[model samples]
Target: MNILELRKKAVQLRKRTWELIYNHKNGHTGSDLSCTDILVALYYNVLNQTPETVGTLEADTYIQSKGHAVEIWYEVLADKGYIDRDDLEKGYSTFNSPYIGHPTTDVKGMEFHTGSLGHGLGLGVGVALAAKMNSLKKHTYVLMGDGEQAEGSIWEAAMAASNYNLDNLTAIIDHNDLQITGTTDSVMRSNPISNKYEAFGWNVIEVDGNDLAALIHVLTSENNTGKPRLIVANTVKGKGITVAENRADWHHKVPSQEEFEEGIRELDAQMEALNHE
Candidate 1:
């Protein structure tokens, strides 16, 4: 898809997220919104796996390190045909549901069950190393929250990825600036993200997290850079909703009926604009 089309799809996905969460009365609303564009770019442009071959070893892998945004991931999976939309809308985060609050490997396209904050990069590093050892051509992509970077384990994994020269690994930080408690700076400052990743010996790129064109360009260019890559995606906390943007309260807060309607309308307008462009 072209950049404009990708943006339209992202707006659609954001609309779906609001609908699903509002319908189910559950989800990490702000975090999910913050990561939607990056997710759209990956599933639509970068990642090589599909619902049909998600189980195959040759397919590329996507691991969500910041697992609270599982709602967005689940929605993307369903949109991509990895799972039925009915199952997603009905069973998400419920008892015996495959769509839990965090991603699980049992889900057709999920590479890991992550929600713990600091563990995803380590898992990604291991997957990248294993792929190198086995001579597999598959790439491993992991998404981490900016707040999650405070965890020491992420650095440990960062060091390992650089040491092993895992060029096939890409870690994108959803730099939404807000976590569950408050702004990331207030909770635990992790700024200078691009510089920090560079210090860790990885190639770092900074982009507007919501910009589909920039995301696709950076990701595609980084693929053959011969070094582990980190894209620090600067994003708003509640990306698609003007009223909720960068508000910490919306991190997991469900919108009221009125707010939900407004959110969907806002996304629809954005989609319409993209379509016209």
Candidate 2:
């Protein structure tokens, strides 16, 4: 899909996720919204994997380290034919549903069970190393939250990735600047993300996380520097919904009925404007 088409698809993805969250009465709303575009760009444009190709040696691997935001991933996977829409919207967060709050291997497109926050990059490095050892050309991408960066494990994995010169590994930090409690900086400052990654001997790029074109260009680029790449996606928390935008309470908060309706209306208006464009 072209960039414009991808943008429209992203808007639709967010709309669907919001509805699912509302119906299910649980979700990490702000985190989900913040990473929706990143997920869309990866699933629809960058990753060389499909529902059928997933788990195969030839398929690229994706791990959502910040697993609380699995709603966005679930919506993208369903749209890409990984899971059924009915099952996702209905069975999500229910008793014994694989569609839990975090990424689970039972889900068709999910590569790993991640929700432990700081462990995703380590897993990604392991996968990338394994692929390299097996002579497989698969790339491993790990999506992490900025708040998760505080964990020492992330830096350990970063050091290992650079030590191995795993150029095929890319880590995307959803720099939404907000976490469950409050602003990431106020909670635990993790600023100068790009420089920190670069200091770890990784190639670093920063871009607006909501911009489809920029994400596509950097993520799909082949300019590997014999080192792992880190894309710090600067994003707004609760991105598309006005009421929740940059609000920390929306991190794991379920929206009120009125908030849900207003969110849908706002997303619909955005979609309409995109269609006209």
**Which candidate achieves the best lDDT against the true structure?**
2
Q: CA lDDT of each candidate?
A: 0.89, 0.92
After the best TM-score superposition of candidate 1, give how far the Cα of residue 193 lies from its true spot, in angstroms.
1.8
TM-score of model number 1: 0.96
Q: How close is every model to the real structure, measured as TM-score? A: 0.96, 0.98
Model 2 lDDT per residue over 1-277, tens place: 9998998998999999898889999899999999999999999888989888898888999989999999989999899999998899889999999999988899999888899889999999999999999999999999999999999999999999999999989999999998888888899998977889999999998999989999999998995489999999999999999998989999988888999999999999999999999
List the lowest-lDDT window of 10 residues for candidate 2. Answer: 217-226
Q: lDDT tens digits, residues 1-277, model 1?
A: 8887788888888898888889888899999999999999999998999888775778888889999998988889899998898999988868898877788888888877788889999998988898899899999999999989999999999999999999999999999888889988889888877888899899888899988888998888746667899999999989989877989999899999999989988988888787777
- Model 2 error, position 96 (Å): 1.1
lDDT of 2 at 206: 93
